[model samples]
Target: MTFRAKQSVRRFILGTAALACACAGTLSAAAAPANLAYDKPAPTINPKLTALSKAMQPKVYKVSNRVYVAVGYGDANSTMVIGDDGLIIIDTTESLTSGRAVEAEFRKISKLPVKGIIYTHHHMDHLGGAAAFVQPQDAMSGKVTVISQADTMKLLASSETAKANPLFTRDIMTARFAYMFGAYLPKGPEGVVNNGTGPAMVAGPVGLVPPNKLVDDTLDVTIAGVRLHIVRTPGETDDAISVWMPDLKMLATGDLLMGETFPNLYTLRGAEIRNPITWYRSIDRVRAFPAEYLVLSHGRPALGRDKVASVLTNHRDAIQYVHDQAVRLMNKGYGPDELAAAISQLPPHLRDDPYLAQFYGSVSSSVRQLYASYFGWFEGDPTTLNLLPPKDRAQRNLALMGGEAHVVAEAQKALAARDYRWVADMLTDVIRVNPSNMNARKLKAQALRQLGYAEVNANARNWYLTSAQELEGAPLQIQNDWFRGVASPQARVAQFNAMPGRAIIGLFAPRLQAERTLDVHKTLAFVLSDSGDQAGIEIRRGIAEVYTQAPPSPDFTVSTTKAALARLAAGDTTLAHLIESNAATVQGDRQGAETFMSYFDPPLKDWSDLHFTTR
Candidate 1:
């Protein structure tokens, strides 16, 4: 089998022997028969995971004289293209701190002014740290060109912007993201070794500067004497784009071909169903580029044409194989779970390639997602349409299994017999019936820990272990650091203040206290003195209807800057204080304006209680 990395760089790759060693150390001990067990080794986390994670160690990979990629400086790789008299930055890392770190390294490479900034997609990992690279004023004035797909901002409105703040689902998505990335787990063997795509998410001030130049299909442009081809390839994201430097023969692929691991056909963290067909076709387009070097946003770069071609082919073929095989089984009357069971592994050729490793994406999960995408959640089973609630079902199951005590006893025996899956399944009922039951929680945590220790997929391992920690109420350093540092109330207030005035007012609709406003009929118009953006809200019946246009006859009008509004929402100040201090002015009834402000819920005091496995 051809390794993805060259022999000299092979140490960067995780060997099959490491995985075998990990299984031999822990899983083998768990499976040993009681009668045959003379001496069992102590349980330990997977060493393969630890070895695989080292690929994210901070280092500047020199692709060529003109291009350099800083990997592991942050969760996402940042590339600096050294052009004559200037520079172009492609995909800033996840946070300002990380971007600064990468910028410092690039300063060592060249001190030329940044002529342009390119975002491959709208993901925070790619664009959030943009502020660290170029000044906002320079980008706005076109002194530095900001290029991206035309649909990037439109897509951002739904997820990354304040428009998403109106939807309660964003909160759940944030919590899931934290869990999927193991954001709260320590960077060690027992916790998170590394993020599947990169190191780990860097939590800090996330900034965004809207693109000035948008790519429709393909654009041929010259920046600082470097001619480049930017092609729109809808793969991992609908707005995904790939950059090809014709002169240098270097292709910079964003998350399209994510790291050395198999492409995440469907991430565990919630996202729109990524079409596998589109993803493979997109790879085919990039395959046409006769690139000598492949610089990726997640993993190490490939140095030769043959090496790059081989890796690209195997990666796309793996995605197509998973898609076709799953659909084939689905046509044969296989359900979601059945399809996952049927297509357990790839073909030997593709399976043997190191690029197709399941370190990030799992065959089972992708297969299940395929089923969901095509057929919805229903599997032609009527019973699933109106099934009993989980709590009620658990209560009934406990009743049938004698009692909670008997169920716990059976789960204990299953754990002893090395049947961790069954133990977890059985204990879910006990936990549901009695959340405070320490015996059930502890046993479930133990089962999950063992399962996590033996799992090679980093995402699944992190999820399992994090869930266990939640059940046991264990403290994590990342959680504390997040709340105290970048994610603090003051920090969030500043973030909100920096958002568009329209977005700040849009959040009002979702935070309205519907019960209190049901009988109240009032209208309030907001005019941002700083940005000159105006929006209005009318409380009628049970809804707070928001409009960009001015209201016909607002009971009162509050004129203030977006910053003051953010502070008011965060409970840092009050409407009365704003009026008294001349920070805001009321054009109409002052009493009505205060009443209008009182109708919305205040910002959350603490987000630490948002757990993945808990209610």
Candidate 2:
């Protein structure tokens, strides 16, 4: 039952090699030189998307003598402050590979040993690439102190990235995210234009360095002779905080205000409902600071107090206006979908302001979220109280509206008439009932392509186009992902140490294949040699639960170091291998426990390049 490691994942839409060949023909202007088309059909031909792509290019902006902001490098930005002694790097980009590049860039500016690192929030974009800036050994030896809000890790454990059902969550978010960031599209005239926040998604590793110093509310710390007042500003996430430099007249606002775009009150990517009211207040709190220079986690820095204040105030008011109006409409009996349409168009005064652009976040999406937050899913309508599931509803609707072919025929008519929206809606039913309906699938793809071309928000455009490609055939999607390599034993141990015993067990429960565990009724005691910590995992029928205290007379006892256990859990080593290699020892019913351990699915359960929709 032990897992044999598979070859590396090879899912790539325009794999790095192919991209170089395609673009190398012409380095500048357009990807395609003359009228000689690129080998593949243009990913998109949207002029707006194409035009905007240039502005999103990554560049390091030098704010002043001490400050520099690296923008559009990856999904996020890395801000560097060269202090009197060593440098203080704030908010590392999403990946270690990217972070390493940013660090190299810093070396060019100043060969300053990193004295400290500050995490503004719990998002991966902010803190995932910590090791690139400073080594774990250095952090342990007290050479560098990683700093963040006290609740940073806790908030991360509950965030969208750390969801209990990650694959399903990705299904809900990936397609949408692709559009928003032009992920699936090639970088050229007719393809991916610009990611609203920045430019590209680069391949890299995810590394996390736990904060040695945690900030609660506000903390005054002088690192490398720079007096920074760390202030709490929980906007995007609960653990959000901002750095105020009294000497430099600068404020590092992490995702709080990402330059030119409407603040995302709620992302289409499923997350705990964000309170816009709290978001606005957080912005207001920052506005109270006499910041002459404003450096954000994403986009260019704003110099001068007047410019900084205007950007902050306008961004805040735009959010307030949208939230207040959405609530007002909800009070007058408006549902989320209805409110989305009703409250989307901002006032001319607000809309004309460039920062409030619907490039990244949209007014409609925010309004929808606002309505949902106040008045749950039910709109006081009994008809919607207990509805059949989508597939069931699709079956019922299909029966009433002829059959799959008939639905496809109608969709064809709609497509011919250029009723793309209607075609999209009607063909969805046809596809749902019969995913093999090539006619319907192609027609729907056509309709979706049109919709994707028309979308302004990066997410919607990417989602539509991604779906269109999926309908075309088996699209290039990751299956059995090999990009995210396993973490080192030391890193794994650090992560495991942070979680409570029960939560750690709950993490593994999702991967337990019920059928495989049906007859494996046993209580196993896991004794960690390194930490001297122990937990009892009781398997009842197909369900598994964990207890802090060890169960007396346990059926099996698995003795292993925390690091070895972490490896076993990660599928780097199996129970059989562990026992053979003497990395782990099982004292009771070794054979039975080995069988039971095999039943637990691999680390990435159901990992694949998913065709998101059921159809």
Alpha carbon lDDT of residue 129, candidate 1?
74
Which residue runs does candidate 2 get wrong by more than 4 Å? 1-48, 82-86, 95-97, 103-116, 128-146, 153-191, 205-210, 478-502, 510-522, 541-543, 567-606
lDDT of 1: 0.75
Clashes of 2: 6
Best by TM-score: 1
RMSD of 2: 7.4
What are the lDDT figures for the candidates, one per model? 0.75, 0.69
Clashes of each: 0, 6
Candidate 2 lDDT (Cα, whole model)?
0.69
Query: Which runs in model 1 stand beyond 4 Å of their true positions?
Result: 1-43, 84-86, 103-116, 128-146, 151-168, 202-212, 475-486, 498-502, 511-524, 553-559, 568-603
